[model samples]
Every structure is written in C-alpha cells, then in structure tokens.
Target: MVLLDMNGTFLFGGDRFGPNQDYASTYRALGGSRLATDVVQTIIQTCFDTLEVIYNDPTRSDSFPQVVDTLRALPAARGVPPADLALLERVIAQHELGRVPDDYAVSLQKLARSHVLGVIANLLSRKDPWLQEFYRAGVLDLFAVTVFPRMVPASSHRGSSSTKQSVRWGSRAPM
Candidate 1:
C-alpha cells in the first residue's frame, strides 16, 4: 500500500498568516506596531495549538480568542491597530490551511486510476472545514482513506509507528 503525507507531498501549505498572505508582508504590514520575532513564532505556534485544542475538544470556541489574548500581551500586539488585528484574525480563521494546486487534482485523477490513493496526515479532524476542504478541492472521493490524529489515541498523534498503525487500521480499502 503506497502512502502519502499530505502537506508538501501533494498539498503545499500556506503561510502562517493564511492564504495568499506571506509572513514577511504580514509583518511589514504591521507598520508602526512592534512584532517581535518571538511573537511571530508564537503566532505560528498558536496555529498548531489551535488545531490540537480543536481536535482534543471539538466543542471549544475559545482557542483563537485565547491565542489572540496571549499575543496581545506580547510586543507583537502591543497597541495593535484594529485593522492589523482584523487581518490577523482573518488569517487565524483560515486555520492556515493551504491551497491544493490544480495539478494535484489532475494527478490524483490519474493516480486513482490504478493506485489506491490515501492520506496519512497529522490532520486535526476528519469533519467539515477539514474534510470539506478535500471536497471543495474536488479530490475527496479520490482518497480511499484519510487518517487523522483525533481518529487514534493521543500517543499515536505524532509517531511513525502510530501513523503506520493508523494507515493499517483506518483504511477503507485493503492495504
């Protein structure tokens, strides 16, 4: 069974600031506001944290707000103008998920003709916005299986052994 890691393997991830926005430009756009390198790192880190928080407890709605509150305490957000924060919020709302290239659909279409395509991602969820992303990208049906962290025990979330186990146990088609 051929396996694929989703990001960078087939889907190229977007910037920390979200779709169509790059980090440098985002930092520069902050203008007078002083956003420290560490704060920027925190912003990026928060992206990952948000996913985990969502995965662990899907009912929580405070992840983004909590992150912003923390950023507000740092120089990164000190006196941050409303407009800049709005942009940041927009980026955060996007979940920093990247766009799938046109070629990916074409390639997936071809690959599915013979090989059984599946995804073994550190993806946070298998539900909407996430799963819907694949649908929106027009490649949802192309995947025979999609493995996500929430689908397995917490220990399996980051290890290769767990990933292999997920692929083995989670697949809809035979491996």
Candidate 2:
C-alpha cells in the first residue's frame, strides 16, 4: 500500500511556494517588494490554474511538458534569471521527478513492516536534476517508483496534475 501527503506531500500548494515567512525572502531575492500573502497566493494559483487548463485539454495527450513551460513563463517567476529559475525548478523537479516526503519512512515501517511505497506528485517542472535533490534528501530509498513530470505521460491516471493515491493498511488507534 502507498500513502501520500496532502498539498506539498501529494499535491502542491501551501507554504511550499511562498505565501508565508519564506515569501519575503523569495520576493526580495527576486528583486520585489514585500508582497502580501494574497499576491504570493495569486502567483501560485495562476500557475496551477494554467496547468489545469493545459492538462484538462482534450486535444493534448501530453500535459506535463506544457505545465513546465507555463510555470517557467509565469510573470511572477520571470526576471528571476536562468540561474534562480534553475534553483526553483530544482525544487519542483525534486517532487515531480523524484520521491515523496521524508516522513513516509515511519508510515511504511508500520505497514507490512516491510511494505514498499512511492510518490506521484503533480508538479510544474520536468527535469532530472529535480529528482537528484530528492535523493540528496533521502527520499529515494523507501519508494520503488518516483513518478514526476515528463516521466509519465499526461493521461487520466498519470501526469503533472495528478492526485495522491491513498493506501489504507489495517486500522489502528487514532492519533
């Protein structure tokens, strides 16, 4: 069985893309003024909204690459220069092309005591370097498969806009 994290775990949103304390750091690094959470949230939402449009398109069989393109082209992310973009892209790639959160080990160790697991997140980038970061973060050992952008074709079940697949082991006492 496999378990996924909500938002940044399985999906993408929340503090991962700013809208929190990191917002000021990122905005300042990118040469912007102190922006409000709403502004930061708008940028994040715009990218996702654009992704939804591209992925949900009936004519396009592949949407992951397009999602990558759209994210790189976002105005909020523009002027960030190729180097910085590369860094941000690496973060997206880590999840999209790499492994799940670090916390998965504990859960997996509980279920089956030897059961294996993996991650399948919908990200906005498609690069192999992204996966490398996950390895550096020790997320590659637990999961057998790490589906990410450009790795899996955009279809009903897989792609950059996919959802988390939950796996329920024998019920235990509530937390």
Residues 64-90, candidate 2: write the lDDT tens digits. Answer: 444445657898866555554444444
- The clash tally of candidate 2 reads 5
lDDT of every model, 2 decimals: 0.54, 0.47
Give lDDT tens digits, candidate 1, residues 12-67. 76434433335434455545255565554566455545555554674432222233
Model 1 misplacement above 4 A: 15-95, 124-127, 150-172
Q: Which ten residues in a row have the lowest lDDT in candidate 1?
A: 60-69
User: Which residue pairs overlap in candidate 1's backbone?
Assistant: none
| Top candidate by TM-score | 1
Measured with C-alpha atoms, the lDDT of residue 104 in candidate 1 is 87
TM-score of each: 0.48, 0.46
Worst 10 residues of 2 by lDDT: 166-175
Quote model 2's TM-score: 0.46
Name model 2 segments beyond 4 Å from true.
Answer: 1-24, 27-45, 56-61, 66-68, 71-80, 87-104, 126-139, 149-175
